[model samples]
Target: MKDFGKDLDEELSSLDAPPLGDLVGEAVRQGRRVRRRRAVGAVVGSALAVAGTALLLGGPLRPHSGGAGPSAVVAADVPSPSPVVRQPVTGAALLAAVAGVVPDGLRTGGYAAQTDGVNGAQVTGAQVYLTGPAGTGMIRVFVTSGESEASCFTTESCRRDDRGQQVVVDHMKGNCVQDVVVTSRHHDGTVVQVNVATCLAWTEAEGNKPTAPALTEQQAIALAGDPALSVWMTAEEGLRAKAAYPDLPRIL
Candidate 1:
C-alpha cells in the first residue's frame, strides 16, 4: 500500500494515449461524414415525394409527347344572334302592303272613304283610289266579323281561292262603265271586299256612264287576298284602326 497509487499513475502515464486535438479532429470529421449522408438521404426522399405528388395530380407536370412546350388551345367562334323582323301593322302599313302588290301601271292616288254593306250588315273599310292608263278607279277593303254565317253573294257569282277562301266577283254592267267588286271571306271569319269602280266621264256633268275599272278581275282578287288586310280583324289592330278612323265601326 505504501507505493500503490504512485505505481498506478506511472503505469497510466507510460501507456500510449491519443492527443486531445487529434481526438477532437477525428470526431469532427466523423460528424461531418454522418451529416453529409443524412443530407443526401433527405434530398433523395424529397425528390421522390415531389414525383409522387405530380403523378397524383392530372400529370400536368409531365413532359409533352411532342417534346415541345404545351401548345395553346384556341376557342371556337360563336355566331351572333340574328336581327328580329317585325310584321307590318296599322292602317298606313296595311295601305302600303296593298300598294306594293297592286298590278303594274296602277298608281296609288290617295286614301278615300267608301261605304258598303255585307249581308245587310253595315261595315266600314279602308279605301284607296288608283289611277292608271286603263282608267281611274277606287279600291276598298272591308273587314267584318260573322262573315262565316253570311251568304257568299246575293247576285254575283262566287268561287273559292287556292287558299279555300270564298271569293265573290260582282261586275256592274252599264254603258261606258266598268265596276268590279271582288270580295273574300278568310278562314278566320273576316270578310275583305275590294271594289273597283270606274267611269269614263272625269266630271259628273259629262254623264254618269261607267268605264272599265283600272284593275282586272284577277288583280282585284289578288289585292283582296293579301294577308296584310287581315290585321284589321285583330283586336289590337282594330283598336288602332278605330283610333285612326274614329268613325270606324266595330264588326265583332
Candidate 2:
C-alpha cells in the first residue's frame, strides 16, 4: 500500500529505450531493395512487350536456309530450232520453180540449159531470158548447182535470208540502165540468180540492148531465197534429165 503507483511508474521508465537509429537504417535498406526489385521487373516487362510488337507488325519469320533466298527465282526452259531439209529437182523443174514466183505480164524468151562435169561429178544449171510486156524491162533467171560467183563480186547491197544465206543485189550501169542482179547460195550448194535487165530501146531497135530488170530488189531477193530452187543440186535428177533429153543444148 505504501506508494505502489509510484513504484510502477519508476519501473516502466527504467526499461531500456528502443533503438531508434537501427530501426531507421533497417527501414531504409528494405525500401531500397523493393525499389531495385521494381526497376528490374519493369525492364524485363518492357523487353517482352517489344518482342511481341515486332512479331505482330512484320511478316511471319522464317528460319534462314543455308542456300539462296526467296529473291533468287528460276527461269523457264526454251525449245530448240528446227533443221532444214532439201529435196531433189531437175533443171526444167528448177526453171519452173523460178517461173512460179515471177509476176504476171512477162513473156518467156529463149533459155539455155547446161550441165558441167568434173571427175564424174556433174553440176547442172540454166539461164532463161524474159521479155517484158509493154516494153517495161527484160528479166533473166539463172539457177545453178553451186555457189553464186556474181554475189561474191559486189558488196553494194547485201542481206541474209532466214537460213542465214547471204543475198547480194547489185545495180549495174552502162549498156543496161537500172539493172538489178540478185544472187544467193543455199545450204545445199545451190545458187539462184535473178537478173532484171530493161532494154533502153524498143524490141525492134537495132543496138538497144536490155537495160534494167523487170523485178525490184525485194522481189529478186524473195526469188533467190526460195527453197524450191534447191532441186537443181540433185545428181540423180540431173542424170535422169540428161538421159531423157540428150539433144538438149548445153550452156554453162
Candidate 3:
C-alpha cells in the first residue's frame, strides 16, 4: 500500500506542473515587448532633443498682433542732419562785377584776378584794362585781409566819407600823364583801392595817353565802394578762376 501511495503522489505533482518549452516561449515574448518599448522611448527622446536644438539656434521670435501681416517696428527719435552751405564767390564773378561798375562805353582789354587762398591769403587783387574814346586805361582793385596803414601822399588828398571810409584821390607824380588812384578803407578793416590810370603796365602799345582815364575819380570811388570785390572767396571757386587766367599773374 505505501508503494502505491508514493507513485500516486508523484503522478499528481507531475500533472500540476507546466511544460518547460511553453515557459521559455512566454519569457521570450516578454523580452521582445520590453525591447520595443525601450526603442520607442529612445526615438521620442531623440526627436525632442533635435527640436530643442533648433529653437536654441534661431533668434527670439517677435510678438505678433491678431492681423496676418507683420506689425510695424517704430524706431527711436533721432536728430536731423544740418543744412548744406555754399562756398564763396569766384574770380570770374569778380571780373564781371568790375565790368558792370565801369562806364557804359568802356570796353574790357584784359584782366588778372585771384581768389583768396589759392594764390595768397594776404591780398585779393583784380585788374581790368578798359579802352574808350578818351584813351586806353586800367582799373585795379585790391582787397587786403587786415587793416592797411597806407595813407595818401598828401594830407589834402585824403578825406573821410559819410560811411566812415577813408578816401584818397591822388595822381601819379612821376608819370608824364597823371594817373588817378581812389583808395577807401572801411570801418570793418577792409581796404579797397581802385587805381584808374591812362597807362597800363602790362601793355606798352596802348598806354600813356595825355587824355583822362577810361573811368573818372568819382566812378573809381563808386567801384571801390562796391561789395562785389571782397577778400572772402571759396577755394574751389578760386581754383576755377585761377584756371580762367592761366597766363596772367595769380595775385596781381
Candidate 4:
C-alpha cells in the first residue's frame, strides 16, 4: 500500500487532530497491502460486508482478517455483468499494458456507473482492490465509477448503488469487492469520507523504501492493521485532488 499523500499528511498532523492521524495511518496500511498483493488478493478470508471496510492513511501494515468477500450479486441469473474497462482510457491503457501478465485467459470487471461518491459527495477517483491467482499479476485500478446526480444527502439508494458499483467482475467471474465507507473529521474540523477494502497491503520495510514513487512492505502492513492510522482531511490536498478532477464533487 504505497500512499501517494503521506508526507503532506505528516506535515498536517504536526499540529493536532489525533483522529486524522488515525485515518492517515490506515491509508498507509492500505498502501502496504496493495504492494504486497500488488493491489490484489493473496489470501481469501470470510465474506466481508460492504459497509465493513473504509479508507485509512497510516503506517504500513497487513490487512486484518476482513472475512472472505461479499456474496456474489448475481445479475438475476442472466448472462452476466457487462465488460468494464472499455477502451480509450489510460487506466484501460495500463490494464492493456499489464494484460499480458494476466494469464487467466480472461479477466474483467468495473464500477456500476462511471463515477462514485465518497462521504456524501461525488468523487472521480475510486479505491479498487482486486484479488488474482497466485503468480498472476495482482491488480488495482482507481478510475471513474460514474456520476451521481441523484441521491445526495441519503445513503439508502446511494449505499446500494455504491456497494454494487465498487465490485469488479473478472472474465465474467467475480473475485473482488469493495469493503466499507467511513466518515472522518479533519484537524480543522472538516468532515471527509474514506473507503477501504481487503488486499495484501505491502509494508515499507519489506516492500520498498519511503520515497517519491513508492513505499515499503513493513510500512504497508503497519498501516493496514492499525486503525489508529486514517487520520484526518487535508483541505489543501482535497482541494488539489478535486481541482485536478473538476468533475468530482468538492464535498470532501
Candidate 5:
C-alpha cells in the first residue's frame, strides 16, 4: 500500500496539470470495502479520468486480513485513451497572428491558407508574400500534430526555448537560396514552423532573387511562438467548415 501510494503520487505529478478534485479522500473512504470488486473498479476508473492517461495498477496491495494470505498483483487491461479533439485554426486567423508581428517596412502580398479539398474553406496553416527594402520574400506558418522532429542541418542552429520547447533556426544564405526558418515545438507536441525566404513561393526556383529574407531569424522565431498561431480544429469542425464556406479563397 505504501508503494502503491507513492506510485500514484509520482504519476499525478508527471501530468501537465494537477488532477481535479480530492481523489485521495475518496480512495481512503473506499479502501474499507475490501471485499467489493466493483468499488475497486470505480476507484480505478476515477484515477484514469483524473490522470488523463492510462494508469498501470501493478503496485503492491495489502490483504484485508492481518495475516499474510497470498502475494497477488492486480493489473487491468484498459484501452488506451483517445487523442484530444480540437478546433482547427483558419487561414485568416493564422495570417492575422502573423500580421501582429510583421515589421513596419514589410508589406504583405498574395497570401493563402490550406483549403478543404475543392470547397475553398480554409483550415490550418497560412502563407503570405512580403515585399520590403531588405528583399521580396514570403512567410509561411503551419501547425502539425504529433511530436515530429528533424535534425538541424549544417547551416542551421538548434536551441531550447525558455518555455520548454526546441527552437531550430536556419538562415540559408548563399548563391541560390537565401531564407530564414524557425521551427518551435509547442507545449502539446504540436509544431509551429515559420519560414521566411527570399522566394515568393517555395515552388518557384527563379523567385529567390532577394539578397536577404524580408523577415529575420528573430522575427521568424517570434511568429512561431505566437499563441494565436498555435491552434487546431477537430475533424467535425473541419467537415462543417468545408460545407459551410464553399466560396472561401484557395490561397495555399
Candidate 6:
C-alpha cells in the first residue's frame, strides 16, 4: 500500500498541483495550484496530464450516471500507502473517521491531525479551506464556493464518512447540485481521493501496484472536473495536458 501511494502521488503531482498537493502524500508547505472545473479548492495532485485534456466542452458532458456511484481512477505513479485524514472535517468525528480504512501497520504510529483556512480570505466571494492530517501538520482538501456548502475527499474515512468512495451526495450544495468526491479506499485499508463539485468525479489511487494511493493520469484529470475547483487548474488556461501526457496503463 505504501508503494502505491508514492507512485500515485507522483502522477497526480505531474498533473494536478504537486506530489504534496496532489492525492495522498507526505505533507508539503501547501503552495501548489492546479486548474479544474470552475472553483479552485485545494491545489494538489500526483500525475495530472496536460495538453488537450479529455474534457468535454464548457457545457454538460452528457456523461453516464451509474446509479451505484461515480467512476474510479487508479494512478500509476503511486509507490507507497499511508493513511492521512483531511482536517476541519464535517459530518463524522475524527479518528473514528478513518478507523477501519488504513492498513493496521500504516496507522501504527497513530494519525496526525490539524486544520487551517486555505488562504485566510485571500480571494473574495469564495473561501478556500485546506485541511487534513499530515505526518504532523494538516493538508488542505476542499473549497467552499459559497458560505453554506463545502465538500472534501476522504479515502475510506469510515468513521467520519457514512458514504463510501464514488458515491455522490447532496451533502452541502446550496440548492441540490451536490458536493461530491471520488474516493479510492478498498475494503482493505488503501484510501485515495479525486473529488469533484459538478461535472465529473475521479479518484487518486495507484494503478499497477496494489499498495500505492495515487490516481492514474486519467483519474487525475477527472478529479479536476469540479465546476468550481477547475478555476485554479493549469487546464483553466486551455493548456493541452492530454496531448502532452498519455493515459497511464493499468498494471496492477
RMSD after CA superposition, every candidate? 51.2, 50.1, 50.0, 22.6, 24.0, 23.3
Model 3 scores a TM of 0.51
lDDT of 4: 0.26
Query: Between the candidate structures 1 and 4, which one is better when assessed by TM-score?
Result: 1
Candidate 3 per-residue lDDT over residues 1-252, each given as its tens digit: 001223433433333211112211111122111112121111111110000111113333354435544354322222334333323345565665577677688888567665443222333456687888866776666554434333343433777666656676655444322256566666645556665655554223543334357687778877776666654544555566556655655421
Q: What is the C-alpha lDDT of each candidate?
A: 0.44, 0.44, 0.47, 0.26, 0.48, 0.25
Clashing residue pairs in candidate 5, if any? 86-234, 87-232, 87-233, 88-232, 88-233, 112-251
Worst 10 residues of 2 by lDDT: 45-54
Off by over 4 Å in 5: 1-86, 115-123, 133-135, 148-156, 171-178, 202-211, 233-252
User: Taking the candidates one at a time, how many backbone clashes does each contain?
Assistant: 5, 7, 0, 90, 6, 75
Ranking by TM-score: 3, 5, 1, 2, 6, 4
Q: Provide the lDDT at 181 for model 2.
A: 57
Error of 1 at 31 (Å): 99
Q: Which structure among the candidates has the greatest TM-score?
A: 3
The alpha-carbon deviation from the true structure for residue 223 of candidate 6, after best TM-score superposition, in angstroms, is: 16
Candidate 4, which ten residues in sequence have the lowest lDDT sum?
A: 166-175
Q: Give a tens-digit lDDT track for model 1, residues 1-252.
A: 011233433433443421212211111122111112121111111110000111112212333346443373322233334433332234443554466678777777646332333234333345566787866665555443334333433444678777777776655443122256566667755556665656432233553334456677887887776666653333455455445555432111
- Model 6: lDDT of residue 141: 28
TM-score of each: 0.46, 0.45, 0.51, 0.19, 0.48, 0.20
